[model samples]
Target: MSRAQNETYLLPFDNRIEINPALAGLNKNSSYQTGNQYHFVNSEQTYNLFYASWDSYSNKLKGGVALNFSQGMLSGQNISTSAIGFYYSGFPIKINNSRILLSAGTEVLAATKHWAVAFLNNVIPHDNDAPIEQGESFFRYYIFKPKFGFLWTNNSLQIGITSTVLHTRDVAFSLIEPTTTLGYTLYVSKKVDKRVRDLYSRPFEMSPELVVFYREEATIARLRLLAEYTDKTWGAFVQNDFTNHISTLGGTIGYRHNFMRFNLNAGMGIPGISDYNSFMCELSLNIIVPPFSHSKYNPWAPAKN
Candidate 1:
C-alpha cells in the first residue's frame, strides 16, 4: 500500500511547529511538547501518531530555532514512517509605529518510510518462508524536503501562511501545500481585576480561530472558539472537508500549573460515508521554561515613601 498524503493537525495553536515553522518560539517562553494521537477510521483501518517538538529563542541570533520529530504507523498493515525536521524563525519586524509585525521562517525535513508484509497463518511452506520474487518482502525509502512560512501579528490579531511541499529531491518545485490561519483575541476583565496588576493576575481571554489547508487533492477548514482564565482552558471546534464533504465535531480541555500544561482533545465524525463510530483522541503536554527575568523581581516588594 502507498503512503497516505492527507493528514491534519487538530490543535493548530498548541502544535504550531507542525502547522507553520514561523510559529517557532512565538509563545512567551521557550517550550517543549509531546503528544500522541489515535485515529479509528473504521474497523479495518486504524492509525497511531506520536510527536515531540522543542523551540527556544536566542537573543544573540535574534531568532527562534526548533527541532521536531514524529512517527506514524498504520495498524494491521505493518507500515510506518519516521520524520525529523529543523525549523527557524526570525524576530518579528515592526511595522511603522503600528502594533503589527511580520515574521518569516523555514524548515528542512528528512523522512523514511518502511513497509513489511507478514505471511498468513499456515501460508508459508517448510523452508520456503523467503519471498518467491526477488526483494519483495519489504520496501524502504527516504525523502527530503523544505518548507517556508510567514506570519503577521498585532496585539490581538494574528495571520499566518505556510507552504509545506515546496521542494523535493526529484522535483525543483513541487505542489505548494498551503496552510493558513487567522485569529482574534478579546479580553474581558472586571474593573477590580484590571486595577489589581500583579504577576499572577491574568485577564479572562476568548479567542476565535480559523484555519484552512489546501492540498492537491483535498481542502480542509476548521472553526474554533476558545476561552482561557488563569490556569484553565476549554474550547470546541467544527472541522469540514470541502473536497470530501466530511465533517467532525470536537472539544478540548486543558489545565496549566507552574511550568507545565496538559490538554486532552477528542473528536467524532458525523454520520456520513462512515457511521458515527469514527473517532479520534489526542493527549498532549507542554513544558515551558520561563525567561531568566521571570524570577528576578519580586512584585510584593514594599514601595519607598
Candidate 2:
C-alpha cells in the first residue's frame, strides 16, 4: 500500500506543524518535539518514520518560526525519503474576541533509491551471456515544496486550513498536485466533583477534534476525543478513509512534567467481514521552554473574571 510522506495518524498532536505550517508557532511558548511511528502492515511488511521539530514565537517579528526534519523508510524497499522544512507565520488579526493568522513555508526533500551491495552481488551475473552493464547503484533526487495556510482561533475554537504543492516542477508548469488539510479543535469544560478537584491541582478539561486530509488519491478523516487533568492527558480517535472505506481505531496517553511531555499511541486497522491485522504504534515527546506560569499563557485563554 502506498503511504503519504506526511501521514501521522496515531500522533497528530505532536506533528501538527507537519500538517499545517500556520501552526509553526501556534503555542504560547517555544517548544521542541520528536517522535517515531512504526507501521506493521502485515506479517512481512513494515514501515518506520521519524521526525523532530523546534518552534518559537518571535515578538519582534510579530509571528513565529520553525525548523523541522523528518525521514521515512520501508522494510523491503531500497528507497528512503527525508525532508527539512522552514516555516513562518505572522501576527494574528483580532476579530471580536477571536484571532486569526496566516502562514507560509517551504521544504527541501531528498529521496534516494539504492541497491545493497549484498543484493547486487547475489543478483548480478558475472560470467553469463547476459552480464549487466555496471553503473551507479543509487539514484538521488531533490524536490522543493511550497505551502501556505491560515488559522483562526478563539478561547474555545480553532480552525486551520493549509495547502501544499508536492513539486516545484508542477508549480512552474501550473500543474500542481496539491495536498490540503482542514483541522478543527474545540475545548469543553464541565463541573468537577469537589473530591476529584481536590486530588488534582487543576480542573479537568475535554476537547473533541476533527481533521480532514485531502489528496489527489484519497480523502481521510479523523475524530478524536481528549481529556486532560493537571498535566496528564488521555485520548481516543477513530479514522476513516472515504475512498478506500478503511477504518482505524486508536488511543493515546500522555504526561507532562516540568518542561517535557511524553506520549504513547497505538492503533489497528478495523476488520470488516474479513479479519485483518494491521497495527501502528508511536512514541512522542515535547518540551515547552519557559513553561506557562500564568493562566494567561495557556494556548486557549480563559474567560476573564
lDDT leader: 2
Predicted candidate 2 versus true structure: per-residue lDDT over 5-106, tens digit per residue: 333222354777776667667755788889998877666556677999888888677788989898876454444668899999876799999788888888
Total clashing residue pairs per candidate?
0, 0
Q: TM-score, each model?
A: 0.71, 0.74
Where does candidate 1 have its weakest 10-residue lDDT segment?
A: 183-192
TM-score for predicted model 1 compared with the true structure: 0.71
**Best candidate, TM-score-wise?**
2
Q: After superposition, how far is residue 304 of candidate 2 from its true place, in Å?
A: 21
lDDT for each residue of candidate 1 in 37-131, tens digit (9 for 90 to 100): 88776777677788899988877767778888877765544456576788778757788542222334443433222333334313455456443
